[model samples]
Target: MTPWTTLLVPDILRRICEYQRGIYEDVVPFRRFLSNGATVHGTSKQAQAFESVLSPWLALYPSISRLVASYEPIKHALACHCAYTGRAGILQHLHKRYILQSVAVNLCQMAIAGQRLDVLEYLVCIGYELPRQFESVYLSWKDQAVFDFVFEHYRPLCTTNTTIYAFASSGNEDALMRLLSYVDEAQIRLMWSVAASHGHVELARTIYTASVDISDHVYQFAGSSFFSTTFQHIKNAANVGSIDGMFWIYDIANPFFSQEDRIAVVGFCLKYAVMENLWDRVWTLLEQADGRVDYPQLLACLPYFKWPQDESNARSMLSSTPALIPMFCTSWLPTIKDQAKRRLLEEELMSMAVLYHDGDRLEAREWLGDVDEYYFNAMEWLMDEYCIDKSIAHDVFQGPLGVAAMKRAIENDHIATMRLLLKYGVQIVPEYIFRRGGIRAIKFYLDKVNPEFTIPVDLLVEMASTPTNDTVFQIVHRTWRARTSITIVHTVESQCIAQAEAHGQVNIIIYLAKSFQSVHSPSEYETFLIQHVQDFYCAFNRARHGVNQLFAIWNPVLDACFNVEFILESLDSLLALTEENLKRLVSLSFVHIPTELIVQCALTNSVLAWRVFCILLDAKIKDKSSRMELQRECLVKKYEGRKFRNVPTVDGLGF
Candidate 1:
């Protein structure tokens, strides 16, 4: 084989290995094929290829061992693939080729991981010893048959309680029963711990029945159990809303748990119960606690209550605890007839909303219905209480609560809240609306504004600086034209063109230029037009430099900063003018045309090169050195067209 083809052999093998291992998610074999009615790690075709193709092919050469020795990871990976895919033929071939003493353990581990009893047997047949104290191997199999095979033939020693725990947790009853005969009392309790934590109640009952001298009370098992297994099962069950499992474990393990453990368990259960909207469970747990709880701790849990799912239930829950109603719950606010209590709930709800900027939470309670004024009162309370503690002040708000809320709505992209705020006559800073609210918010605001109100020309120009909805510019121009003169319109379009050029908004410049062309003759705005085109050429040069600095990162920020070739193609309509028009514009501006632009223009379209490069010469923008280089490059191009006489020199040409 050629050297290049030979060098690619390892990489090719690795890719094949990856394919067998299902590393490529988009590949056909991995997604479509299944093994034993489950998603396959390796397809049958992969196994056949390993056995029929790769194994026999490698066997023909003694250099196969050298290749395996050179790339050790690939060798191990190949071995793993063989064991995992149950390709015993290739595995035997690999053993015959390269069986290093150190690699035997890894091969055995992979065999066990393969969950194939035959592969394990083959490794032993090849004189490889299985590791002593095989807890990991025991933990590996969820299949009962594999465990049974290991027990019948191999029976590797067990050192820790981990094997039984894994068996119990995996719900392998047959494996756990077989394992129960071997372990002592400590390991037996550990098995019970796993069963209790995982809610394997029948398995726990089986262990209690099978084991001798075990008490009916679970505290006997709990004392020697893992600490996390003891206390955490309660929280785990509570978190998953497994009330039966939680209470069963609680009733069993109650004697062993400390006061702190009980508090943590109750707190965690109460919090999730509230969030899960388990009202019956919440009331029952609260009644069982019977004022043993810290009121402040329970009050803290009230804020997280799932108010949206059952608002009436939440109201009743809050009303049952009247003091917390004044603190956290907002559902009761709509029903509270007392003015003082209504104000208190309103202040608390809005304070939480403003502090968290949680629009969904605030919206859930319908607190914004007639409470427009209360939003500011809430902001004040936040400033005095919450903000003051953090050394923050009222300056966080732009103006009134409604305007602040409107800004928050814009930031969070909450359109409904924005409309509601606007409907309530919340005045907003027009620039902030244009900048942050984007086109949709701008349209909403414009639709709500009085007919006489037009967005300020300066703000419109600012918006035009970046790419925004073209419809906004059209609307502003259409509205502003009726009140203003053609001269003022020309000036507005000119400033917009300048802003668009400065920010490299090629499309916007084209749009504004087309709009300007419709209104007036080109000659009337010749100076302004020339300056705008010059600014574009300069901006393009900066964009090229900016692109070199920030490589491979693409986003809107990058587009705004470093828009390149697409800008050239997009601006063709505005820039592809006649030669004389281009020359006159370039000459009037007095800025140097970039030589790179000339070269790119030549390459992009040779016809447009004449129009663009002629301006470079006529404007005296091409310096003597650049002129010589361009001439020399042209001479070389010209000479290369035929049998060359001699290589051209810059000095040979007349200066």
Candidate 2:
């Protein structure tokens, strides 16, 4: 091989020499050029020179092999690169040049860290070994395969406390089991604190059970303070709502917690249970505390309760601590910022007073002295429970309170209370009656209370627009009966017809259309039909009943419009209309009817076509006009083209 100096020109040599001066200044770029130089034209002398310059840079770039491989001394950099990149082939090349004990040790650590099984096997094949403490790195990496390989092939390394800590902290039970064969009791006990910190509950329990003296170990591990000790493990379980872990710690380990600490634990557990609305667990923990937790402590944690709107939870909490009611009635109720929560609390207190205290008139009176403020709220609850006395009912029905209370009663279907309020001279609010009370209540009030009262026309329209039952139609019919003005009656009638038709109410539509036609003027009826033609057709199409019923509802509008296109489009109506009605329609609107539509209808139903031919013949007989004759001829030719034979003619028609 040519010497490196002969391979390079003088300018390149000058660049290499300059590179040597600043080799330390810019190691990365210079090392890149040196690797290129060596690969292209390298000799033993240049390789030796490059080795001296590139040694310090190896620590900065362990993964870059070209920079490190340009040097021969410290060929371990090559092994390091091989191990780092999981390239075992390069390790074999370096092995031929030098014995790499340090490299082998580093390779084992890297294999464990990178989870490279091939590198580990290569090291073992080369008779390279690892120290005992290197197991800590393996344990920390939590790679069970590598740990097992190292443990089985290598002589058992003495397990250290740190290794045990890493095993427990990682929550790897299998690794800890392997270590347990060599670890002492004291070292295993030290593992508990870390296990607890990492929420390794099962591992901690295993440690406790395996101990020769668990109580001493648990006491030592739990230490003196509640906040800082391993007792936090139990508290952490409680915070996460881990019931099983908390029970495990309490039952198995039974650490020596101070009385204050015990109470703190109970409080934490209760707070979590209440926040989660786990009433069963809350009661369990409360009973376990055995009355150690006071009312004030629970009240301080009231914000944690999730269901402030639930009456059952309020009752449960109040029933748990009855003594708190007096304070809740007087102090807490007024101080609570959430009115909804305060109202629920008051309702529960009132119910309890009624159930437990024999109606406790004085306490009830004090609680309800602000009656006007909470009158509706109190009345609603009392009326629902059937516990309101006549005097309370009478007192609550004074002035506008009676109006408001009656409205609520009507909304809640409290007919008895409604009668009670009315008997006590509570006047009804007409709008409220219209809004809350349906037709039944309205009729009852109109017939029984005041016959002179009139529901607003807008209110009637609004109610008609809304979806209603059959009773609304009855109410509207009754209102039409009672009203005197024809215009208002027709307007209500027309709007109600449109609204009812929109909802596909066939019975209501029939009744309204019949009623409308009975009192309807020609112009008014025509205008109504014209305005609602689209809506009427839509209703007819979407009608749920049979063809006969829809015909009854839609016949009048069809006859008045006499629109041939519409009748042809509605195939159901075309087939269902009687021959007499079809004849009358054709006779009245023959000029407006198209020949194609007539042809289609005749092709569909030939008997109807014969009737139309008779009508056209009757028209031609009466007039004998050329246009009528031409129309007759065209329709006759179209019908005859179908080859429909044996058609009967109307006997009454003279052609």
| Candidate 1 residue runs with Cα over 4 Å from true position | 1-194, 197-339, 357-400, 411-413, 464-483, 502-505, 518-655
Candidate with best lDDT: 2
1-655, model 2: which lDDT tens digit per residue?
A: 2334321333343343344533322323233432422321222234344454433433334323433343332354345545644767667655664566744345565555556677878887888676555545333346666667766776354266656666766777776666665666556655654565466777877776666453444344343453444457666666655656665555443346555665666666666566666677767666666435655666655765444354466566555444444434433444567866655555556444322233332122122122222323434444455443444444545655456556655555454545656876787777677666766567767777768776677776565556555575567566745765765787676677677667666566666665666776876666766666665666665555544554554556564564434544554454455656555544655335544544454444466555554453453345557545545555565457555455533222232
For residue 288, give model 2's deviation from the true position in Å.
Answer: 6.7
Prediction 2 TM-score vs. true = 0.36
Residue 229: error of model 1 in Å? 19
What would the C-alpha RMSD of candidate 1 be, to one decimal place? 23.6
Global lDDT scores for all candidate models: 0.53, 0.54
Q: How many backbone clashes does candidate 2 have?
A: 0
